[model samples]
Target: METQMGTVEDNEGNTYQTVTIGAQTWLAENLRATKFQDGSAVNTGFIPKDDDANLLTFGRLYDWHDVIDERNICPKGWRVATDNDWKLLERAIGISELEVNKEGWRGKNDIAITLKAAQPDTIFKKFNQADVNKFHFFATPAGVKLGNWYITQDMYTEFWTGSSATEKDAYARTLAYSWWNSHKGQIRRAKLQKSNMFSVRCVKI
Candidate 1:
Protein backbone atom coordinates (compact mmCIF):
# COMPACT_ATOMS: atom_id res chain seq x y z
CA MET A 1 0.00 0.00 0.00
CA GLU A 2 1.24 3.51 -0.84
CA THR A 3 0.93 6.39 1.65
CA GLN A 4 1.79 10.10 1.53
CA MET A 5 2.29 12.23 4.63
CA GLY A 6 2.01 16.01 4.98
CA THR A 7 1.14 18.73 7.47
CA VAL A 8 -1.56 21.39 7.99
CA GLU A 9 -1.60 24.45 10.21
CA ASP A 10 -4.59 25.48 12.30
CA ASN A 11 -5.75 29.02 12.99
CA GLU A 12 -4.14 28.60 16.37
CA GLY A 13 -0.83 27.88 14.65
CA ASN A 14 -0.81 24.23 15.70
CA THR A 15 0.53 21.99 12.99
CA TYR A 16 -0.80 18.45 12.57
CA GLN A 17 0.61 15.76 10.37
CA THR A 18 -1.66 14.64 7.54
CA VAL A 19 -1.77 11.19 5.98
CA THR A 20 -3.40 10.35 2.68
CA ILE A 21 -5.44 7.16 2.82
CA GLY A 22 -7.02 6.08 -0.43
CA ALA A 23 -8.08 9.48 -1.83
CA GLN A 24 -8.78 11.19 1.47
CA THR A 25 -6.35 13.22 3.58
CA TRP A 26 -6.83 12.85 7.33
CA LEU A 27 -5.15 14.46 10.29
CA ALA A 28 -2.77 12.05 11.99
CA GLU A 29 -3.69 13.67 15.31
CA ASN A 30 -6.84 14.82 17.07
CA LEU A 31 -7.75 18.53 16.73
CA ARG A 32 -6.30 20.70 19.48
CA ALA A 33 -7.22 24.15 18.25
CA THR A 34 -8.67 26.40 20.96
CA LYS A 35 -10.11 28.89 18.50
CA PHE A 36 -12.40 28.80 15.51
CA GLN A 37 -11.37 29.69 11.98
CA ASP A 38 -11.93 33.41 12.55
CA GLY A 39 -9.71 33.29 15.65
CA SER A 40 -12.57 33.61 18.14
CA ALA A 41 -12.21 31.72 21.36
CA VAL A 42 -13.95 28.36 21.63
CA ASN A 43 -15.25 28.51 25.16
CA THR A 44 -17.69 25.68 25.57
CA GLY A 45 -16.76 22.07 26.19
CA PHE A 46 -13.07 22.89 25.62
CA ILE A 47 -10.92 21.01 28.07
CA PRO A 48 -8.10 23.19 29.38
CA LYS A 49 -4.57 21.93 29.13
CA ASP A 50 -3.87 21.15 32.74
CA ASP A 51 -1.86 18.14 31.69
CA ASP A 52 0.28 18.78 28.62
CA ALA A 53 0.88 15.08 28.04
CA ASN A 54 -2.81 14.18 27.83
CA LEU A 55 -3.56 17.24 25.72
CA LEU A 56 -0.84 16.25 23.28
CA THR A 57 -2.08 12.65 23.06
CA PHE A 58 -5.85 13.13 22.98
CA GLY A 59 -6.20 16.67 21.67
CA ARG A 60 -9.28 18.48 22.93
CA LEU A 61 -12.78 17.20 23.67
CA TYR A 62 -15.56 19.10 21.94
CA ASP A 63 -19.33 19.08 21.89
CA TRP A 64 -21.41 18.98 18.70
CA HIS A 65 -22.16 22.68 19.00
CA ASP A 66 -18.49 23.55 19.11
CA VAL A 67 -17.91 21.26 16.15
CA ILE A 68 -20.61 22.82 13.95
CA ASP A 69 -19.90 26.42 14.76
CA GLU A 70 -20.14 28.63 11.72
CA ARG A 71 -16.71 29.96 12.60
CA ASN A 72 -15.41 26.41 11.99
CA ILE A 73 -13.62 24.24 14.49
CA CYS A 74 -11.14 22.59 12.16
CA PRO A 75 -8.12 24.27 10.65
CA LYS A 76 -8.28 26.00 7.28
CA GLY A 77 -8.63 23.60 4.31
CA TRP A 78 -10.08 20.89 6.56
CA ARG A 79 -13.44 20.26 8.16
CA VAL A 80 -14.87 17.85 10.64
CA ALA A 81 -15.62 14.47 9.12
CA THR A 82 -19.23 14.18 8.09
CA ASP A 83 -21.14 10.93 8.07
CA ASN A 84 -20.42 10.51 4.36
CA ASP A 85 -16.75 11.24 4.89
CA TRP A 86 -16.56 8.51 7.51
CA LYS A 87 -18.43 6.17 5.18
CA LEU A 88 -15.86 6.89 2.51
CA LEU A 89 -13.12 6.04 4.98
CA GLU A 90 -14.81 2.80 5.89
CA ARG A 91 -15.20 1.89 2.24
CA ALA A 92 -11.54 2.64 1.64
CA ILE A 93 -10.75 0.10 4.32
CA GLY A 94 -12.79 -2.54 2.39
CA ILE A 95 -16.09 -2.24 4.26
CA SER A 96 -19.04 -2.37 1.89
CA GLU A 97 -20.50 1.03 1.09
CA LEU A 98 -23.87 -0.58 1.83
CA GLU A 99 -22.87 -0.95 5.45
CA VAL A 100 -21.14 2.43 5.55
CA ASN A 101 -24.09 4.84 5.65
CA LYS A 102 -26.45 2.78 7.83
CA GLU A 103 -27.69 4.87 10.72
CA GLY A 104 -27.42 2.93 13.96
CA TRP A 105 -24.54 0.70 15.01
CA ARG A 106 -24.07 -0.71 11.53
CA GLY A 107 -21.16 -2.67 10.00
CA LYS A 108 -19.34 -5.73 11.27
CA ASN A 109 -17.99 -5.46 14.81
CA ASP A 110 -14.43 -5.93 13.58
CA ILE A 111 -14.18 -2.58 11.79
CA ALA A 112 -13.06 -0.99 15.04
CA ILE A 113 -10.15 -3.38 15.32
CA THR A 114 -9.10 -2.32 11.85
CA LEU A 115 -9.30 1.49 12.27
CA LYS A 116 -8.49 1.82 15.95
CA ALA A 117 -4.95 2.95 16.72
CA ALA A 118 -2.63 0.60 18.46
CA GLN A 119 -2.65 1.65 22.09
CA PRO A 120 0.76 2.88 23.19
CA ASP A 121 2.68 0.43 25.31
CA THR A 122 3.58 3.43 27.47
CA ILE A 123 -0.08 4.05 28.28
CA PHE A 124 -1.83 0.71 28.02
CA LYS A 125 1.14 -1.52 28.73
CA LYS A 126 -0.95 -4.39 30.10
CA PHE A 127 -2.88 -4.86 26.82
CA ASN A 128 -0.16 -6.03 24.48
CA GLN A 129 -2.64 -6.27 21.62
CA ALA A 130 -2.16 -3.93 18.65
CA ASP A 131 -4.71 -2.78 16.09
CA VAL A 132 -4.38 -3.74 12.43
CA ASN A 133 -4.55 -0.03 11.36
CA LYS A 134 -4.98 -0.92 7.70
CA PHE A 135 -5.29 2.70 6.51
CA HIS A 136 -2.91 4.51 8.85
CA PHE A 137 -5.72 6.66 10.21
CA PHE A 138 -4.04 6.56 13.64
CA ALA A 139 -7.27 6.75 15.68
CA THR A 140 -6.31 6.66 19.33
CA PRO A 141 -8.51 5.77 22.28
CA ALA A 142 -9.01 9.40 23.40
CA GLY A 143 -12.21 8.64 25.29
CA VAL A 144 -15.03 11.12 26.03
CA LYS A 145 -16.20 13.67 28.58
CA LEU A 146 -19.66 13.93 30.14
CA GLY A 147 -20.50 17.17 31.92
CA ASN A 148 -18.18 17.63 34.89
CA TRP A 149 -16.93 14.09 34.87
CA TYR A 150 -14.44 12.48 32.51
CA ILE A 151 -15.27 8.84 31.93
CA THR A 152 -13.81 5.99 29.85
CA GLN A 153 -10.39 7.66 29.65
CA ASP A 154 -8.51 4.71 28.20
CA MET A 155 -11.24 2.14 27.55
CA TYR A 156 -13.48 3.70 24.88
CA THR A 157 -12.95 6.03 21.95
CA GLU A 158 -15.44 8.12 19.97
CA PHE A 159 -15.49 10.74 17.20
CA TRP A 160 -18.25 13.15 16.15
CA THR A 161 -19.74 13.03 12.67
CA GLY A 162 -20.80 16.34 11.13
CA SER A 163 -24.30 14.93 10.63
CA SER A 164 -27.02 15.58 13.15
CA ALA A 165 -29.73 12.93 13.53
CA THR A 166 -32.30 15.18 15.18
CA GLU A 167 -32.64 18.44 17.05
CA LYS A 168 -31.47 16.79 20.24
CA ASP A 169 -29.11 14.09 19.04
CA ALA A 170 -26.19 13.89 16.63
CA TYR A 171 -24.44 11.01 14.92
CA ALA A 172 -21.08 9.65 16.09
CA ARG A 173 -18.82 6.60 15.74
CA THR A 174 -17.15 4.66 18.52
CA LEU A 175 -14.67 1.89 19.32
CA ALA A 176 -14.22 0.06 22.59
CA TYR A 177 -11.50 -2.14 24.01
CA SER A 178 -14.03 -4.19 25.90
CA TRP A 179 -15.91 -7.03 24.19
CA TRP A 180 -13.66 -7.01 21.10
CA ASN A 181 -16.11 -9.34 19.34
CA SER A 182 -19.79 -9.69 20.03
CA HIS A 183 -22.74 -9.11 17.72
CA LYS A 184 -22.60 -5.23 17.78
CA GLY A 185 -20.17 -4.99 20.55
CA GLN A 186 -16.93 -3.34 19.42
CA ILE A 187 -17.77 -0.73 16.78
CA ARG A 188 -21.04 1.21 16.87
CA ARG A 189 -22.71 4.16 15.16
CA ALA A 190 -24.29 6.06 18.00
CA LYS A 191 -26.76 8.94 18.08
CA LEU A 192 -25.71 10.90 21.08
CA GLN A 193 -26.98 14.13 22.61
CA LYS A 194 -25.39 17.20 21.05
CA SER A 195 -23.94 18.27 24.37
CA ASN A 196 -22.03 15.05 24.91
CA MET A 197 -18.33 15.61 24.33
CA PHE A 198 -16.10 13.50 22.07
CA SER A 199 -12.77 13.82 20.30
CA VAL A 200 -12.70 15.40 16.84
CA ARG A 201 -10.76 14.29 13.77
CA CYS A 202 -10.70 16.40 10.61
CA VAL A 203 -10.73 15.45 6.93
CA LYS A 204 -9.27 17.56 4.18
CA ILE A 205 -11.79 19.35 2.01
Candidate 2:
Protein backbone atom coordinates (compact mmCIF):
# COMPACT_ATOMS: atom_id res chain seq x y z
CA MET A 1 0.00 0.00 0.00
CA GLU A 2 2.84 2.43 -0.33
CA THR A 3 1.61 4.12 -3.50
CA GLN A 4 4.11 5.87 -5.77
CA MET A 5 2.81 8.71 -7.98
CA GLY A 6 4.03 9.94 -11.39
CA THR A 7 2.94 10.76 -14.95
CA VAL A 8 3.02 8.93 -18.28
CA GLU A 9 3.45 11.05 -21.40
CA ASP A 10 1.68 9.92 -24.51
CA ASN A 11 3.06 10.53 -27.99
CA GLU A 12 0.96 13.69 -28.00
CA GLY A 13 2.68 14.74 -24.79
CA ASN A 14 -0.48 14.24 -22.73
CA THR A 15 0.66 13.66 -19.19
CA TYR A 16 -1.71 11.29 -17.39
CA GLN A 17 -1.85 10.61 -13.68
CA THR A 18 -0.12 7.47 -12.53
CA VAL A 19 -0.33 5.53 -9.28
CA THR A 20 1.02 2.28 -7.86
CA ILE A 21 -1.66 -0.14 -6.69
CA GLY A 22 -0.54 -3.44 -5.23
CA ALA A 23 2.34 -4.45 -7.51
CA GLN A 24 0.78 -2.88 -10.59
CA THR A 25 1.06 0.72 -11.73
CA TRP A 26 -2.19 2.20 -12.97
CA LEU A 27 -3.32 5.44 -14.52
CA ALA A 28 -5.51 7.39 -12.12
CA GLU A 29 -8.00 8.04 -14.93
CA ASN A 30 -9.56 6.36 -17.95
CA LEU A 31 -7.84 6.12 -21.34
CA ARG A 32 -9.30 8.80 -23.60
CA ALA A 33 -7.71 7.20 -26.56
CA THR A 34 -8.56 9.28 -29.62
CA LYS A 35 -6.47 7.00 -31.76
CA PHE A 36 -4.31 3.94 -31.55
CA GLN A 37 -1.07 4.47 -29.71
CA ASP A 38 0.39 4.74 -33.22
CA GLY A 39 -2.17 7.42 -34.19
CA SER A 40 -4.82 5.21 -35.82
CA ALA A 41 -8.54 5.69 -35.17
CA VAL A 42 -9.95 3.85 -32.13
CA ASN A 43 -13.70 4.41 -32.56
CA THR A 44 -15.82 1.67 -34.14
CA GLY A 45 -18.79 3.29 -35.87
CA PHE A 46 -21.65 2.18 -38.14
CA ILE A 47 -19.32 1.04 -40.88
CA PRO A 48 -16.62 0.67 -38.23
CA LYS A 49 -13.75 2.25 -40.14
CA ASP A 50 -11.79 5.49 -39.71
CA ASP A 51 -11.82 8.73 -37.73
CA ASP A 52 -15.37 9.49 -38.88
CA ALA A 53 -16.52 6.80 -36.47
CA ASN A 54 -14.09 8.04 -33.84
CA LEU A 55 -15.63 9.12 -30.51
CA LEU A 56 -15.48 12.48 -28.78
CA THR A 57 -16.96 11.41 -25.48
CA PHE A 58 -15.40 9.01 -23.07
CA GLY A 59 -12.97 8.82 -25.98
CA ARG A 60 -14.64 5.97 -27.83
CA LEU A 61 -16.04 3.04 -25.84
CA TYR A 62 -14.54 0.01 -27.56
CA ASP A 63 -16.07 -3.45 -27.72
CA TRP A 64 -14.34 -6.83 -27.65
CA HIS A 65 -13.76 -6.31 -31.35
CA ASP A 66 -11.28 -3.47 -30.82
CA VAL A 67 -9.98 -4.75 -27.49
CA ILE A 68 -8.92 -8.19 -28.74
CA ASP A 69 -7.10 -6.56 -31.64
CA GLU A 70 -3.44 -7.47 -31.09
CA ARG A 71 -2.33 -4.13 -32.47
CA ASN A 72 -3.28 -2.76 -29.05
CA ILE A 73 -4.96 0.67 -28.86
CA CYS A 74 -3.24 1.98 -25.76
CA PRO A 75 0.28 3.45 -25.73
CA LYS A 76 3.26 1.15 -26.03
CA GLY A 77 3.52 -1.11 -23.00
CA TRP A 78 -0.14 -0.32 -22.17
CA ARG A 79 -3.31 -1.97 -23.39
CA VAL A 80 -6.99 -1.62 -22.77
CA ALA A 81 -8.23 -3.32 -19.62
CA THR A 82 -10.07 -6.61 -19.91
CA ASP A 83 -13.00 -7.81 -17.81
CA ASN A 84 -10.63 -9.72 -15.55
CA ASP A 85 -8.52 -6.62 -14.97
CA TRP A 86 -11.67 -4.71 -14.06
CA LYS A 87 -12.46 -7.39 -11.50
CA LEU A 88 -9.14 -7.01 -9.71
CA LEU A 89 -9.74 -3.31 -8.96
CA GLU A 90 -13.17 -4.17 -7.57
CA ARG A 91 -11.72 -6.97 -5.49
CA ALA A 92 -9.02 -4.78 -4.04
CA ILE A 93 -11.71 -2.31 -3.05
CA GLY A 94 -13.91 -5.07 -1.62
CA ILE A 95 -16.83 -4.53 -3.99
CA SER A 96 -18.83 -6.85 -6.25
CA GLU A 97 -19.63 -6.22 -9.93
CA LEU A 98 -23.27 -7.31 -9.57
CA GLU A 99 -23.96 -4.75 -6.82
CA VAL A 100 -22.11 -1.89 -8.57
CA ASN A 101 -25.27 -0.23 -9.88
CA LYS A 102 -27.63 -0.54 -6.91
CA GLU A 103 -28.64 3.15 -6.81
CA GLY A 104 -26.48 4.58 -4.02
CA TRP A 105 -23.02 4.75 -2.53
CA ARG A 106 -21.81 2.04 -0.16
CA GLY A 107 -19.02 3.17 2.13
CA LYS A 108 -17.49 -0.27 1.79
CA ASN A 109 -17.31 0.07 -2.01
CA ASP A 110 -16.79 3.78 -2.51
CA ILE A 111 -13.21 3.39 -3.76
CA ALA A 112 -14.37 4.23 -7.28
CA ILE A 113 -15.82 7.46 -5.96
CA THR A 114 -12.51 8.29 -4.37
CA LEU A 115 -10.95 7.96 -7.82
CA LYS A 116 -13.44 10.30 -9.55
CA ALA A 117 -12.36 13.92 -9.85
CA ALA A 118 -14.62 16.54 -8.35
CA GLN A 119 -17.63 17.31 -10.57
CA PRO A 120 -17.01 20.23 -12.89
CA ASP A 121 -19.25 23.25 -13.55
CA THR A 122 -20.28 22.16 -17.05
CA ILE A 123 -21.18 18.79 -18.54
CA PHE A 124 -21.53 17.68 -22.20
CA LYS A 125 -20.98 21.38 -22.84
CA LYS A 126 -24.09 22.17 -20.77
CA PHE A 127 -23.99 25.13 -18.41
CA ASN A 128 -23.37 24.94 -14.67
CA GLN A 129 -21.85 21.46 -14.58
CA ALA A 130 -22.10 19.61 -11.27
CA ASP A 131 -19.84 17.06 -9.43
CA VAL A 132 -17.13 17.75 -6.89
CA ASN A 133 -14.51 15.35 -8.29
CA LYS A 134 -14.10 14.09 -4.71
CA PHE A 135 -11.82 11.49 -6.22
CA HIS A 136 -8.91 12.49 -8.44
CA PHE A 137 -10.53 10.59 -11.29
CA PHE A 138 -12.28 13.85 -12.25
CA ALA A 139 -15.05 12.03 -14.12
CA THR A 140 -16.85 14.47 -16.40
CA PRO A 141 -20.52 14.19 -17.33
CA ALA A 142 -19.30 12.58 -20.58
CA GLY A 143 -23.10 12.20 -21.08
CA VAL A 144 -23.94 8.68 -22.26
CA LYS A 145 -27.34 9.46 -23.84
CA LEU A 146 -29.43 6.44 -24.68
CA GLY A 147 -32.91 7.89 -25.17
CA ASN A 148 -33.82 11.34 -23.92
CA TRP A 149 -30.65 11.50 -21.78
CA TYR A 150 -29.75 8.43 -19.71
CA ILE A 151 -28.55 10.33 -16.67
CA THR A 152 -29.60 8.85 -13.34
CA GLN A 153 -30.47 10.67 -10.08
CA ASP A 154 -26.96 12.14 -9.70
CA MET A 155 -25.71 12.37 -13.28
CA TYR A 156 -22.46 14.14 -12.68
CA THR A 157 -19.72 11.52 -13.10
CA GLU A 158 -19.52 8.59 -15.55
CA PHE A 159 -16.76 6.12 -16.47
CA TRP A 160 -16.23 3.21 -18.89
CA THR A 161 -14.29 -0.02 -18.42
CA GLY A 162 -12.60 -2.02 -21.18
CA SER A 163 -14.95 -5.02 -20.73
CA SER A 164 -17.94 -5.55 -22.98
CA ALA A 165 -21.40 -6.28 -21.59
CA THR A 166 -22.62 -8.23 -24.61
CA GLU A 167 -22.19 -8.54 -28.35
CA LYS A 168 -22.86 -4.89 -29.19
CA ASP A 169 -23.05 -3.50 -25.69
CA ALA A 170 -20.30 -2.78 -23.16
CA TYR A 171 -20.06 -2.11 -19.42
CA ALA A 172 -19.64 1.40 -17.97
CA ARG A 173 -18.58 2.27 -14.43
CA THR A 174 -20.29 5.15 -12.63
CA LEU A 175 -21.15 6.71 -9.27
CA ALA A 176 -23.50 9.42 -7.90
CA TYR A 177 -23.73 11.81 -4.97
CA SER A 178 -27.51 11.67 -4.65
CA TRP A 179 -27.47 8.05 -3.55
CA TRP A 180 -25.85 6.48 -0.47
CA ASN A 181 -22.33 7.08 -1.87
CA SER A 182 -21.48 3.84 -3.75
CA HIS A 183 -20.13 2.79 -7.12
CA LYS A 184 -22.34 1.37 -9.92
CA GLY A 185 -21.95 -0.36 -13.26
CA GLN A 186 -24.01 0.28 -16.39
CA ILE A 187 -24.32 -1.92 -19.47
CA ARG A 188 -24.53 0.12 -22.70
CA ARG A 189 -26.14 -1.84 -25.54
CA ALA A 190 -26.13 0.73 -28.31
CA LYS A 191 -23.71 1.22 -31.17
CA LEU A 192 -20.75 3.53 -30.69
CA GLN A 193 -21.26 7.19 -31.53
CA LYS A 194 -19.27 10.39 -31.22
CA SER A 195 -20.36 13.55 -29.29
CA ASN A 196 -20.37 11.80 -25.94
CA MET A 197 -17.47 12.56 -23.55
CA PHE A 198 -15.98 10.53 -20.66
CA SER A 199 -12.77 10.15 -18.68
CA VAL A 200 -10.13 7.40 -18.91
CA ARG A 201 -7.89 5.85 -16.23
CA CYS A 202 -5.50 3.03 -17.23
CA VAL A 203 -3.80 0.13 -15.45
CA LYS A 204 -0.21 -1.01 -16.05
CA ILE A 205 1.04 -4.60 -16.18
Candidate 3:
Protein backbone atom coordinates (compact mmCIF):
# COMPACT_ATOMS: atom_id res chain seq x y z
CA MET A 1 0.00 0.00 0.00
CA GLU A 2 1.12 3.52 -0.60
CA THR A 3 1.61 5.46 2.58
CA GLN A 4 1.20 9.21 2.87
CA MET A 5 4.37 11.22 2.28
CA GLY A 6 4.59 13.16 5.53
CA THR A 7 5.52 11.98 9.01
CA VAL A 8 4.24 13.19 12.36
CA GLU A 9 6.58 14.63 14.96
CA ASP A 10 6.35 16.92 17.94
CA ASN A 11 7.24 20.61 17.72
CA GLU A 12 10.58 19.99 19.41
CA GLY A 13 11.90 17.74 16.66
CA ASN A 14 13.53 19.08 13.47
CA THR A 15 11.72 16.79 11.03
CA TYR A 16 9.40 17.99 8.28
CA GLN A 17 7.12 16.02 6.02
CA THR A 18 8.40 15.54 2.48
CA VAL A 19 5.66 14.12 0.35
CA THR A 20 5.68 12.61 -3.10
CA ILE A 21 2.94 14.07 -5.17
CA GLY A 22 2.53 13.32 -8.87
CA ALA A 23 6.05 11.95 -9.28
CA GLN A 24 7.53 14.82 -7.29
CA THR A 25 9.11 14.44 -3.88
CA TRP A 26 8.51 17.74 -2.17
CA LEU A 27 8.84 19.28 1.22
CA ALA A 28 5.75 20.31 3.14
CA GLU A 29 7.83 23.22 4.37
CA ASN A 30 6.93 26.77 3.47
CA LEU A 31 8.41 27.79 0.15
CA ARG A 32 11.37 30.10 0.49
CA ALA A 33 11.78 30.43 -3.22
CA THR A 34 14.20 33.28 -3.85
CA LYS A 35 13.69 32.83 -7.55
CA PHE A 36 10.68 31.72 -9.48
CA GLN A 37 10.93 27.93 -9.84
CA ASP A 38 11.95 28.17 -13.49
CA GLY A 39 15.04 30.22 -12.69
CA SER A 40 13.45 33.24 -14.23
CA ALA A 41 14.20 36.68 -12.83
CA VAL A 42 11.87 37.62 -9.96
CA ASN A 43 11.69 40.80 -7.94
CA THR A 44 13.58 40.51 -4.66
CA GLY A 45 13.20 44.18 -3.82
CA PHE A 46 9.89 43.26 -2.15
CA ILE A 47 12.27 41.96 0.42
CA PRO A 48 15.64 43.56 1.03
CA LYS A 49 18.08 42.09 -1.49
CA ASP A 50 20.40 41.77 1.46
CA ASP A 51 18.11 40.12 4.01
CA ASP A 52 19.93 37.21 5.64
CA ALA A 53 18.94 34.21 3.55
CA ASN A 54 19.28 31.93 6.53
CA LEU A 55 16.85 33.88 8.69
CA LEU A 56 14.36 33.93 5.84
CA THR A 57 14.81 30.22 6.08
CA PHE A 58 11.68 29.05 4.31
CA GLY A 59 11.70 30.99 1.02
CA ARG A 60 10.99 34.46 -0.28
CA LEU A 61 7.53 35.72 0.51
CA TYR A 62 5.26 36.25 -2.48
CA ASP A 63 2.14 38.35 -2.54
CA TRP A 64 -1.20 36.69 -3.28
CA HIS A 65 -1.25 38.46 -6.63
CA ASP A 66 2.13 37.03 -7.46
CA VAL A 67 1.04 33.54 -6.52
CA ILE A 68 -2.00 34.11 -8.71
CA ASP A 69 0.24 35.02 -11.64
CA GLU A 70 0.95 31.85 -13.59
CA ARG A 71 4.17 33.31 -15.00
CA ASN A 72 5.99 31.24 -12.34
CA ILE A 73 6.81 30.33 -8.67
CA CYS A 74 6.41 26.57 -8.20
CA PRO A 75 8.68 24.04 -9.90
CA LYS A 76 8.14 22.04 -13.12
CA GLY A 77 5.92 19.30 -11.68
CA TRP A 78 4.21 21.52 -9.12
CA ARG A 79 1.94 24.52 -8.92
CA VAL A 80 1.18 26.77 -6.01
CA ALA A 81 -1.67 25.15 -4.12
CA THR A 82 -5.17 26.53 -3.86
CA ASP A 83 -7.58 26.97 -0.98
CA ASN A 84 -9.13 23.64 -1.76
CA ASP A 85 -5.79 21.91 -1.57
CA TRP A 86 -5.17 23.30 1.89
CA LYS A 87 -8.63 22.22 2.91
CA LEU A 88 -7.80 18.70 1.89
CA LEU A 89 -4.80 18.68 4.19
CA GLU A 90 -6.84 19.99 7.03
CA ARG A 91 -9.32 17.22 6.52
CA ALA A 92 -6.60 14.59 6.41
CA ILE A 93 -5.39 15.66 9.86
CA GLY A 94 -8.84 15.73 11.37
CA ILE A 95 -8.71 19.50 11.82
CA SER A 96 -11.89 20.24 9.97
CA GLU A 97 -14.53 22.46 11.52
CA LEU A 98 -17.84 23.44 9.98
CA GLU A 99 -18.18 25.89 12.87
CA VAL A 100 -15.55 27.78 14.87
CA ASN A 101 -13.52 27.15 17.99
CA LYS A 102 -14.25 29.00 21.21
CA GLU A 103 -11.99 31.75 19.85
CA GLY A 104 -14.24 32.14 16.80
CA TRP A 105 -11.32 31.40 14.50
CA ARG A 106 -12.17 30.85 10.83
CA GLY A 107 -10.13 27.84 9.74
CA LYS A 108 -9.75 24.39 11.26
CA ASN A 109 -8.01 24.04 14.60
CA ASP A 110 -6.75 20.45 14.95
CA ILE A 111 -3.82 20.61 12.54
CA ALA A 112 -1.84 23.42 14.11
CA ILE A 113 0.71 21.28 15.91
CA THR A 114 0.77 18.79 13.03
CA LEU A 115 1.79 21.59 10.73
CA LYS A 116 4.24 23.24 13.12
CA ALA A 117 7.91 22.85 12.42
CA ALA A 118 10.04 21.59 15.26
CA GLN A 119 11.41 24.64 17.00
CA PRO A 120 11.04 24.14 20.71
CA ASP A 121 12.52 27.54 21.39
CA THR A 122 9.99 29.16 19.10
CA ILE A 123 6.94 27.00 19.78
CA PHE A 124 3.86 28.77 21.07
CA LYS A 125 3.39 28.36 24.79
CA LYS A 126 -0.01 27.12 25.97
CA PHE A 127 -1.16 26.31 29.47
CA ASN A 128 2.18 25.00 30.67
CA GLN A 129 3.54 22.99 27.72
CA ALA A 130 5.45 24.32 24.76
CA ASP A 131 4.37 22.64 21.51
CA VAL A 132 6.68 19.85 20.53
CA ASN A 133 5.24 20.45 17.05
CA LYS A 134 3.80 16.93 17.18
CA PHE A 135 2.86 17.35 13.55
CA HIS A 136 6.12 17.92 11.63
CA PHE A 137 4.83 21.31 10.50
CA PHE A 138 7.85 23.27 11.75
CA ALA A 139 5.99 26.54 11.41
CA THR A 140 8.29 29.44 12.26
CA PRO A 141 7.54 33.06 12.98
CA ALA A 142 9.06 34.84 10.01
CA GLY A 143 8.25 38.55 10.23
CA VAL A 144 6.10 40.00 7.46
CA LYS A 145 5.51 43.39 5.81
CA LEU A 146 3.23 46.33 5.14
CA GLY A 147 4.83 47.59 1.96
CA ASN A 148 8.43 47.85 3.16
CA TRP A 149 7.60 48.26 6.82
CA TYR A 150 8.76 45.07 8.57
CA ILE A 151 6.50 44.12 11.42
CA THR A 152 6.24 41.60 14.27
CA GLN A 153 9.05 39.08 14.23
CA ASP A 154 8.87 37.15 17.50
CA MET A 155 5.12 36.67 17.35
CA TYR A 156 3.79 35.85 13.93
CA THR A 157 4.15 33.74 10.82
CA GLU A 158 1.63 35.32 8.51
CA PHE A 159 1.66 33.19 5.39
CA TRP A 160 -0.10 33.41 2.05
CA THR A 161 -2.97 30.99 2.52
CA GLY A 162 -3.61 30.99 -1.26
CA SER A 163 -6.85 32.80 -0.60
CA SER A 164 -7.66 36.44 -1.22
CA ALA A 165 -9.65 39.33 0.15
CA THR A 166 -11.79 41.59 -2.01
CA GLU A 167 -9.14 44.33 -2.31
CA LYS A 168 -5.51 44.73 -3.29
CA ASP A 169 -4.28 43.72 0.12
CA ALA A 170 -3.99 39.93 -0.21
CA TYR A 171 -5.40 37.50 2.32
CA ALA A 172 -3.15 35.44 4.58
CA ARG A 173 -3.21 33.22 7.68
CA THR A 174 -0.98 33.84 10.66
CA LEU A 175 0.09 31.39 13.35
CA ALA A 176 1.40 32.94 16.53
CA TYR A 177 4.40 31.18 18.04
CA SER A 178 4.12 32.81 21.44
CA TRP A 179 0.54 31.97 22.20
CA TRP A 180 -0.66 28.85 23.99
CA ASN A 181 -3.36 27.76 21.59
CA SER A 182 -3.52 27.28 17.82
CA HIS A 183 -7.22 28.13 17.93
CA LYS A 184 -6.35 31.80 17.71
CA GLY A 185 -5.07 31.91 14.12
CA GLN A 186 -5.12 35.35 12.53
CA ILE A 187 -5.93 36.14 8.91
CA ARG A 188 -4.67 39.42 7.45
CA ARG A 189 -3.83 41.22 4.21
CA ALA A 190 -0.90 42.32 1.99
CA LYS A 191 -1.34 46.08 1.65
CA LEU A 192 -1.46 46.06 5.44
CA GLN A 193 2.21 45.05 5.37
CA LYS A 194 3.64 45.66 1.95
CA SER A 195 6.95 46.42 3.65
CA ASN A 196 7.45 43.17 5.51
CA MET A 197 9.17 40.28 3.70
CA PHE A 198 8.76 36.83 5.18
CA SER A 199 8.97 33.13 4.16
CA VAL A 200 7.27 30.77 1.77
CA ARG A 201 6.17 27.13 1.65
CA CYS A 202 4.45 25.77 -1.44
CA VAL A 203 2.21 22.73 -1.64
CA LYS A 204 2.26 20.22 -4.53
CA ILE A 205 -1.13 20.28 -6.12
Per lDDT, the best of the predicted structures is 1
lDDT of each: 0.75, 0.46, 0.49
lDDT of 3 by residue, 1-205 (tens): 1224663222223344566433334456665454554455556424423366633354356566556556556554456654455455444445445632212244433335545554333255332124334434566666565565666655667766455545554445566655554443332223233223455555654
Task: Please list the residue runs of candidate 3 whose C-alpha ends up more than 4 Å from where it truly belongs after superposition.
Answer: 1-17, 20-26, 45-50, 53-56, 100-111, 118-131, 179-198
Measured against the true structure, the TM-scores of the candidates, in listed sequence, are 0.85, 0.58, 0.65
CA shift of 170, model 1, Å: 0.8
- List RMSD in Å for every model shown: 3.8, 7.9, 7.0
User: For residues 1-205, what per-residue lDDT tens digits would candidate 1 score against the true structure?
Assistant: 5668899998778999888888899998888988999889886535523456787777888999999988889988889999778888777766676777665555553555556566333332233244456556667767787787677766777899889999998989887654332421235677899988888889999
User: Which candidate should be chosen as best, given TM-score against the real structure?
Assistant: 1
- Candidates ranked by TM-score, best first? 1, 3, 2
Residue 157, model 2, lDDT: 44
lDDT of 2 by residue, 1-205 (tens): 3457777866655567777655566776545555566677765412112233223323433334555456665667776655456556555444555643443343352344444444322323221222222223444344343333333323544444566555655554545543332232221222232233333456775
Quality of model 1 by C-alpha lDDT: 0.75
